[model samples]
Target: MATRVLLLMALTLYIFPIATATFHVKGSVYCDTCRAGFETNATFYIRGARVGIQCKERKTMKVAFYSEGVTDSTGTYHIEVENDHRDNICECLLVKSPIKWCSTPDSGRDKSSIVLTHYQNGIVNHLHYANAMGYLRDEPLPECHKLLKYYLADSDV
Candidate 1:
C-alpha cells in the first residue's frame, strides 16, 4: 500500500505540469495590398506589426489573460501563454500595422481564434497556431483590378 501510494504520487507530480503546460501561439500578419479581403500574389507580409493574444472567461466574458507581441522581419509573431484556459475563450488579435496606408484591420480577418489548453487539444509539443490575419489598404492598388481578375469567376474574369 505504501509503495502504491508513492508511485501514484510520483505519477501525479510528473503529469500535473504537463497538463498545465505553457503554449506558444505562432502566427503571421500581412498587408492586403490590393484591399481584396484575402491574400493574393500582391499580399505583403508586414514587419514590425503589433499583435496580441487575449483570453476571456467563457461565462462572464471577463478578460482572463492578455499578452502582446510584434511581428519579426518575416512577419511572424510568437507569443507564449502560460496555464491552461480550457473554459476560456482565446484569440490572436491584430493590434497595429506599421504601414500608414495599411493600418485598417481587415473586417473579417482581424483575429484568429485559438485553443490554449494542451489537455483537450492533444498537442504534445504545446505549440498552437492561429490563422494568419491581415490589414487592409486605404485604397486598392492601381493594378489590383487586373490582378483580382484571376480570383473571379469565369464570367467576371
Candidate 2:
C-alpha cells in the first residue's frame, strides 16, 4: 500500500504541467553619427547601436529585469529573452538621434517591423512598422492629406 501511494504521487507530479509567463526584451536600432531614425529615408542603417530591455509587471506595475546590448554596423540591437510575466509591456526607442529634433513614431500605435517574441526565445527579424501613413515617403505632404486623421492622432514622439 505504501509503495502504491508513492508511485501515484510521483505520477501526478510528472503529469502536471508547469505554467510560466513570458516577458519581452526589446529596443530600437539607430546610427551613431547621424542620430536620425535608422533606415528612415533610404535604408537607414545602424551599425553597432545599443539595445536594452526593461521588464515590468502588468497588474501590480513592477519592474523585474533590465539588460542592454550593442548593435553591429547594421544598427541592429539585441537582448536576452525576458522570462515569466505576460502582463509586462516591452519597448525599444532610439536613444540618441543624429538629429535631435527629428520626429518619432507614436508609441503603442505606429507599427514598425520591430522584432517581437511571445513566450519564446528567438530573434524575430523584420517585424515591419505600421501606422497612419503606410511608410516614410519623400512625396509632398499634401499628397497624403487624406491620411491626416491617422497620423495626427497622439504620437509617441
Candidate 3:
C-alpha cells in the first residue's frame, strides 16, 4: 500500500504544470550611425524598418524562436514575447530597408535589419539608421546614455 501511495504522489508531481509570468520588450528606432532620430520627411515613399526578436537555447546555443516588428515614422517600436529560461538568451534586431543612398555598402544597408540584445521592457530609440554613404548600420550609438546603451544590452532569461 505504501509503495502504491508513493508511486501516485510521484506521478502527480510529474504531471503538474509549471507557471511563469510574461514580460514585455519595447524600444524606439533610429539611424545606425548618426544616432539621429528618424521621422517621416518629404520622402513619404520610404517605408519604416522592421525589427526582429530571437531566442537562443541555453545549452545548445542555437536559435529556438524568431518574431518580427515594424517601426513607426517617428522611429518607435514595441514588441511582446514570451520569456525563456534564466540561461536562455534574447535579442532584438533591425532587418530590411527600402532607400538607395541609405542602402550603401559601408552604410551596412541591405533591407533594414538591426540586431539588439540585452534590453527588455524599456525604451530603445533611434539606435538604427543609414549613414551618409547610403549603407545601413543597425546598432546603437557608442554613448553611455541610458537609451543608447540598451542597443547592446542582451538578457539571459
Best-performing candidate as measured by lDDT = 1
> Sorted by lDDT, highest first, which candidate order results?
1, 3, 2
Model 2 lDDT, full chain set: 0.40
Best by TM-score: 1
Tens digits of per-residue lDDT for model 1 on 1-157?
9999999998775555455568999999999999988999999899999999999999999999999999999999999998888889999999999899999999889999999875544555678889999999998889989888867856643
TM-score of each: 0.85, 0.41, 0.45
**Candidate 3 — what's its lDDT?**
0.47
Full-model lDDT, candidate 1: 0.90
State the lDDT at 26 in candidate 1: 97
Candidate 3, position 41, lDDT: 26
- Local distance difference test values of all predictions, in order: 0.90, 0.40, 0.47
* 91: Cα error in model 2, Å: 2.1
Q: Which 10 consecutive positions of candidate 2 have the poorest summed lDDT?
A: 128-137
What is the Cα-based TM-score of model 3?
0.45
Report how far residue 114 has shifted in candidate 3, in Å: 14
lDDT of 2 at 119: 34
Is candidate 2 or 3 superior in TM-score? 3
